[model samples]
Target: MQDITDVAKRLVQHNKGKITEVYFVACGGSLVDMYVSDYFIRSESTTITSGWYTANEFVHATPKRLGKNSVVIACSHGGNTPETVEAARIAKAAGAQTVGLTYNDKADLLAVSDYSFLYEWGDETRVHNNPMAIMLELTVGMVNELEGYDHYNTFMEGMKLIDTIVASAEKQVEPRAKAFADAYKDEEMFYVMASGASYGHAYGFSICSLMEMQWLDATAVHTGEFFHGPLEITDENTPFILAMGLGRTRELDERVLKFLKRYAKKIEVVDAKELGLDMIDDSVSEYFNPVLFYSVLSKYRYALSKVHNHDLDVRRYMGKVEY
Candidate 1:
């Protein structure tokens, strides 16, 4: 990961004035992993804009801004995702500096990238800390360098504290996660909602975990958009999983929570403020809550799979054949 920071710095330094924005491209979990980075870059810098796309769509629509002066970031778990690897190739062909973040150093995506970051770890490390953290670190560090924000240095100094926070969060969330899975393991449908910083978590968990992993029907809606249409689908028995972030948008989630309490019997709220993340400084907690939300809700997924006796890795179509 140290190499990743250097790669990020060099990417920024080399593209300095030429680059006006960065495009993060991937698919599924990888795409979701970049949401926080996209949000961070947009929120933290005025000089640059951040955009994201699934690699397939990125290849088909090819943004005009993705050119010689742009930076393209592609992420994949194994780094061999065909669409992502091809997207990296296209970006490079366009004279954009490409960075690939993956778990495997030898991934095909790396071969096309100008720079790549690989986190080599044993099995336990996979669950201990997600690749999402690495993506966050790399993106945040790069933006910090570009904007001259010293938060990067502070974050480096706090890695140990961050690890402690993750461990503690796991312990704090496991029981609740099990309870949630045990209760909802048989439920055929669910509605997940959130806004602000944690909206990505709600969206990703609903898509990647509930719909994709468990093959369940789930809907993810931004709290602000809930009343727009989704509200009509709720009733006394509807189940909801609300991801409440500890940011300015808390009020948005709170409004939905208030409404749900009156209408839904099975409403599970995963509030970042209530989670045991006090060790993380308040100064950065708001910024870090998205990744923390991943750590907390991921446990729910583990429990969900367990109670249903379904292996999380089971897939009927993903890797079995060409799409």
Candidate 2:
């Protein structure tokens, strides 16, 4: 967590002069890209653009957009995907400097790019992409060429909270997770509500485990949007995990908890405080919570992967998509 934080801060510092913009590209799991884009916009004087496509769309329609002044960070968990590699190759061909994000030093996302940073995690667990997602967000700050931020100790202090939460949750959430997973484990679908920092949490949880592990269409939603109209989709039978947060918006925390209790099938609170997760309440900037949450909250994914008897790495067997 701290390492990635430093990477982000460093990127911002290093690229301060040559570029005035940044781009995040991904195919399917592009939530991480969005998080980084938000960070760049908030912290620097650069235009942050996020674009997504299936590998083929990117290859056929957008791959030519890269250039020397462009610093492209392309991501894939396995690094072996045909499209990510193809995309990176295209970027290189078009004279764009590229970096690959992955967990494996030898994967294609790394192989095709000029430099790659493998996230410091070893599990494929339930959500193999957690590390990648969080790392991308953490590293984004560095890529933006911004200066004067002290994030290393700050981010780890936040991650410490996550570590604390999981250590306690290892004992506390099992029954809850098992009960929820078993009850909806066989069900066809569910929903996830994520607001603020937890949006990244919900994004990873829904896509990697709730949807991928169970083969359900778990969703990530913003609470404001939920109240607008999507709230109609909530029901007594729809299992939900509300990604409660203790970030900049305490109001969101209150609203999410209240709504989940009344409408969600089985409401789970990721009370960043009560879980006994080691967290630094004061030092963290909320935009970076995904780094901490995944480092700690992600244990649940590993636990579920074990419960389902799946391999440690989901992508080892589950290829990106079918032809």
Candidate 3:
């Protein structure tokens, strides 16, 4: 993780002001790409064009939507999945400079990219996506000229703050994740509520999308559309996770918190202000919580996977695929 961030700083130094804005084309694992793009938005002037596609349709559907003056940022944990690699190929043929971020050194994803960031973990670390997302956050920070912290030393210090919060989170993670998972586990459907930068939380919602691929149990809803009515009807078996959000409208977040406590069956908060990091307050300002979110979120999912008898590395089955 340290080396990935350091290399990213160099990439940012190298690419500083070279382009007008970055276009982050995210695909592959949902939370990983979502947080990476969130970090990019903080680091640079960026626009995200989703790179996801139905594997069969991507070949004909991509290309015209991508091209010069853009960078295709692809995330593939395995590094060599057929659809992701082929999507990277389409991204390149359209004249965009491609960069592959992944855990392996050599794979078809790297083959199609002009540049790559390799994290060296062949599978998601500890069967959660934190290691990969951390690398992506550092990559975005590095490429954005490292705006907030002038020295990498300061960034390391900030990470230490995150580590401290993570320790406390370890004590509470299981209970919180299980509370939501147990409620959600039996549901045929549900919604995830997120808005603003926290809207990136929807990436986790994609567990339902890929669950068909990996066959996990997940259902979710967005926060805004949810509160319009259903907020009053939830029970223990159906719950909502509040990415209560941050920034100028913090008063609104307070309201949401109150409403969740009153109307919803349960509420779980990934409080940016509580992460025991220098960035905690800043997580609210910059939505920098994604990096913090990844570490803690990874643990939550790990606990739930155990209770459900699902593979920890749900994206990879029994270590069968190697890149």
Among the numbered candidates, top TM-score falls to 1
List model 2 lDDT by residue over 204-293, tens digit each.
677876566645577787765777887787788766666555556546767866886876656666555555433454445454445445
Question: Can you give the TM-score per candidate against the true fold?
Answer: 0.93, 0.74, 0.69
Query: What is the C-alpha local distance difference test score of candidate 2?
Result: 0.57
Off by over 4 Å in 3: 1-21, 26-32, 35-59, 63-65, 120-160, 175-190, 205-217, 229-237, 245-253, 277-285, 313-323
lDDT comparison, 1 vs 2, better candidate:
1
Model 3 lowest lDDT segment of ten: 120-129
Error of 1 at 27 (Å): 0.6
Candidates' C-alpha lDDT:
0.80, 0.57, 0.54
| Model 1 lDDT tens row, 1-323 | 54657876887888654567889899988888788778878777777788889999999999988888888999998999989999999999999999888888678998888887776444246422456667777777777777766566665654446666666777888999998888887799989998866777788999999888899998789999998999998897788999887766788899999999988889998887777555566555656677677777878888999998888899889889977
Best by lDDT: 1
Cα miss at 218, model 1 (Å)? 0.8
Number of backbone collisions per candidate: 0, 17, 7
Off by over 4 Å in 2: 1-16, 27-57, 61-66, 123-130, 133-145, 150-153, 156-171, 263-265, 276-278, 283-285, 292-322
> TM-score for model 2?
0.74
Residues 45-78 of candidate 3 have per-residue lDDT tens digits of 4433333344335555664556664555666767
Better of 2 and 3 by TM-score: 2
